[model samples]
Target: MTKKMTWNEMSPSQQTGVLVTGSIQLALAATAWIDLAKRPAERVNGPKALWAAIIGINFVGPIAWFIWGRRR
Candidate 1:
């Protein structure tokens, strides 16, 4: 089995890739949450509360929200 690497054990490029990917995920989630907050109940395809929770998931959640959550 492969061993897990800690943050300190990762190389600079690997670290940078992780950071960048994490930043993108956070941004997408934040944008989805913000849209949910500002949008009306009727404007959203599903329950806002459900979307709120789903937004916490990684890239998939936010992308799903953007693609299928909104009425538009």
Candidate 2:
């Protein structure tokens, strides 16, 4: 899995799968973001201000993960 992979090596479905999964996660975070006030107390205390950070870090995590943390 460490080997670098070109887009061509991934099947059409595989490519779509990665995109759809990432998109879903992005959408969920964006949607959940709207209701920070409604956020249950637990998340507030833990992910708390962390979750409530401006959209900047919220997105940066995913991008960083994709670039530096990808299995390959």
Candidate 3:
């Protein structure tokens, strides 16, 4: 079986990478949420409340919104 390394056991670079990835995810989610909030109800493909909940979901939620929620 493979040994699992705890956070304290990870190398500095590995930890940095994890932190950076997490930060990016947060940023993307925030941006998507803000954009959704600023959009008028008529411009969104779905209901504003539904999009708000969807955007709260981790990485995939924001991506889905950008891809499917916004009207062309």
Candidate 4:
């Protein structure tokens, strides 16, 4: 098994990359959730509850929701 690197062990660039990626993930999920909440069931392609769950699936989920889950 390989040793896991902690935040302190990460290089500055790696740390920045991680932070940026994490922020993007958080923003995407938040946006998807907000859109899902404000959008009606009829407007969404699937159940809002299911989309809400899918939104938690990191990058792919939110992107998929924006591209396919919404009726528009």
- Report the lDDT tens digits of candidate 3 across residue range 1-72: 999989999999999999999998899889998999888889899798998898888899999999999986
How many clashing residue pairs are found in candidate 1?
0
TM-score of 3: 0.84
* Winner of 3 and 4 under lDDT: 4
Can you give the TM-score per candidate against the true fold? 0.95, 0.50, 0.84, 0.95
Q: In model 1, what lDDT does residue 30 have?
A: 91
lDDT of 4: 0.95
lDDT (Cα, 0-100) at 70 in candidate 4 = 93
User: Candidate 3 at residue 45, lDDT?
Assistant: 93
List, residue by residue over 1-72, the lDDT tens digit for candidate 1.
999999999999999999999999999999999999999999999799999998898899999999999997
Model 4 misplacement above 4 A:
none
- Mark the regions of model 3 whose C-alpha exceeds 4 Å error after superposition: 1-5
Candidate 2's C-alpha runs over 4 A off are 37-48, 53-72
Q: lDDT per residue, candidate 2, 2-40, as tens digits?
A: 997788999999899989988877775565455555656
C-alpha lDDT of residue 2 in model 4: 100
Tell me the deviation in Å of residue 62 in model 3. Answer: 0.7
